[model samples]
Target: MADKQDKSQTKPTSLQATIAGGFAGLLCIAPLDVVKINMQLQTNRLEGLKWAKRGIVHQTKGIYKEFGARGFWRGNASAQWLYLFYGGSQFFAYDQIKRALAKTDLSSESKHFISGAVAGTFATVTTYPFDILRTRFAAQSKDRVYTSVLDGFQKMAKAEGFRGLYTGLAPSIVSILPQAGLMFVGYEALAPVFKELNLPFGAGDFLAGAVASGAAKTAVFPLDLIRKRLQVQGPARSKLAYGAIPEYKRNMFAAGRAILQNEGPRGLYRGLVIGVLKAAPTASLYFWFNARALEILVQNEIFA
Candidate 1:
């Protein structure tokens, strides 16, 4: 009876821990995400560290000049919902896919990759419009803004039509495949190493998760560039802009060439440093918390 009570108590504690970890992780990286998006949208002619340093400096100056330190987190309210839907869905889908794959004869790596891809695809398909709004809100200047998430959504829909909400669906979906696949593969591969080194489960999970996120982001960095451009720019500038000339069909390829021509090969990886900075800690914390939470829940039979 004592053992049963202990078990029952364990699950809730674990679940609480997991939820705590995930939210903590999200808060940690929110500022970094702001930095990353700013960097990606900068049109200045700086390069390498000069470009990076300028972006950071400019962002800091803008934040201080506008909303002080708080200005940097401008879209955070809407972002909370964005992350909740996107992050929650992705994590949930990942677990579900992984569990289903566990019954198969596939290798752990194969399972992880497939699970990640499926999770990404599922999450994107379900919550893409919110994603578009989040980007718009994040990319907005302090002077020009949407009053709220619903305001942004309604405005975009009214102005651009229903399809505006899915402006960058093609590159966004394609980008998810490799990004998610690499993230899971990297996480699964590195987890054992940390375990072998005798680190605690939470610490090991975070470290592995960070590495996986970095790897995944690096792999799909180019796709992200394309997607962001399409999302931020209106129909005329996007690759999705279709017409009698089939101009939109060629816009994607043309955009790739323009990036290379104007910004050089390195332009394809704009904001990569910020991406790594953000992804590593975010993923690490998310997985660490998630695993710990699940273990606790299962032990208490909350998940059984």
Candidate 2:
């Protein structure tokens, strides 16, 4: 049974599975992403956890009222690029690298963790600019910036050179390395219990992934918030009153401190609830579809 399980696991983490995961993640995560960006950028409240007041329902309604149904999908263009690349590349690296390392003397857990971190960093570094653009499109409300994806890229290049697209990349890499390592390693490790239960259609794998990813996402939520804030700092700072510190997000440590001082401890947790809700389902669907897609591909001898 253990050997069978190992074979199944090896088969499922394929390029086909990676592509399916990307599509599934995009569908599940795009709407919640917009809401999360909005909540994170909320600055009107003078006290504890302003996001506590603006629940998902409230944010959804406001976005609908202001931008209509399309509002829910504001940054989908960049999100599509981001999700496709991020989702596919992450699993691809994790799958291939781990398989290659299986010949070595490394323990399984170390292999899983290392592969996940490597894949995540490669994917993130390769496609990070798209994420910045997606966050920018999702975070802003009025006086629109960057009419389109091309325009966003052009603006970033013109304003801050190629580096403009990578505003918060350092902190993001720092945050994501551990988060990705934890999420994938934990999910892969826990997934077999579901197989033992014989959950239909790999439902148990989905559940395991959700639980693992939820935990990882929570642990890294503050870093995620800081990354988002840094991504949008340019526009926020640019519009600031004259003499205002136009680069508040220049330093992740300082930005974190500012959030603590201004918005209190809960400020670091902005959009955390929504992030968890979004992450659980998204991660579940991601793993589930990746497995299912690989199963199909294997059954057809596509990669055999």
Candidate 3:
């Protein structure tokens, strides 16, 4: 029975299973992200929860009226690539880092937090462009102004120069550290408690992951807002609108100052509610699926 149990545990822990679960979770929240971005970029009188609620209503109305509910998934195709690279790399790096840290005497919480931060930072660096692209796609309307990701990239490059690809990189990187640290730390702290209580891993993982994601996202939401504003704002509208992109224009503080002056501190946290809404489901699904996948892999004798 011990041998059989070991083989069963091994079945769900394969690397591929974990990756697939991550991707699936990301895909699940693509529509919510689209709605969230639309709310963020609204220029009319609507603002905050009022704006977000209205936006969701408008989007739902439009989808029902026009595309028959399928419109909500407008950017899903591009999002798949975003998820594949960003989600896969994040989990892959996170798992690897955790494994390495497990060899040390550090507390599980410490290892999990540090490993998550490192993994998030590394994944962000590698896949920031795809993230930018995903946002662009999500922010588009059914009218199809940009056409495709390549077109958006080309237009951004031509309009703003090569630097456009990394418009919001600074705040994005800063936000990742705390957000990811809290997430993993929370997950690690809760996992054992769940096990002790003899609950299913999926339920425990989702609840733990959701709480962790919400906390982390809330903590760093201001920075995330700044990053999104920078990424989505046009070059013609930014302080960098000097007709020529400068090599020394990579200062996040300066950019933040400009944003504050132009849009106020409240602008720094635009769409926070939507962000939390999107993140909760995304993170919950990821941990739930990933835990289940890991269980399956462990059971299959794939990663014992």
lDDT pick, better of 2 and 3: 2
Q: Please report the TM-score between candidate 3 and the true structure.
A: 0.80
- Whole-model lDDT, model 3: 0.68
Model 1, residue 279: C-alpha shift (Å): 1.0
Q: By descending TM-score, how would the candidates be arranged?
A: 2, 1, 3
Candidate No. with top TM-score: 2
Per-residue lDDT tens digits for candidate 2, residues 23-69, read 65555577888888777766544134332256788777877776788
Off by over 4 Å in 1: 1-28, 44-53, 235-251
Q: Please provide, for model 1 over 1-304, each residue's C-alpha lDDT reduced to its tens digit, 9 standing for 90 to 100.
A: 8886676555333234435434543544667777776666544332322323455666557545645677567567767776666666776677678778879999988999998898888878878887776666556654554678788777778877888888778888888988888888888899888878788545888889888888888888887876766666654232111111112232556666767777678877778888788888888877786676666656656635
lDDT (0-100) at residue 112 of candidate 1? 91
C-alpha positional error of residue 117 in candidate 1 after TM-score superposition, expressed in Å:
0.7
**lDDT pick, better of 1 and 2:** 2
Q: Report the candidate with higher TM-score, 2 versus 3.
A: 2
Relative to the unseen true structure, what is the C-alpha lDDT of residue 17 in candidate 2, on a scale of 0 to 100? 58
Error at 159, model 1, angstroms: 1.0
Q: How far off is residue 178 in model 1, in Å?
A: 1.1
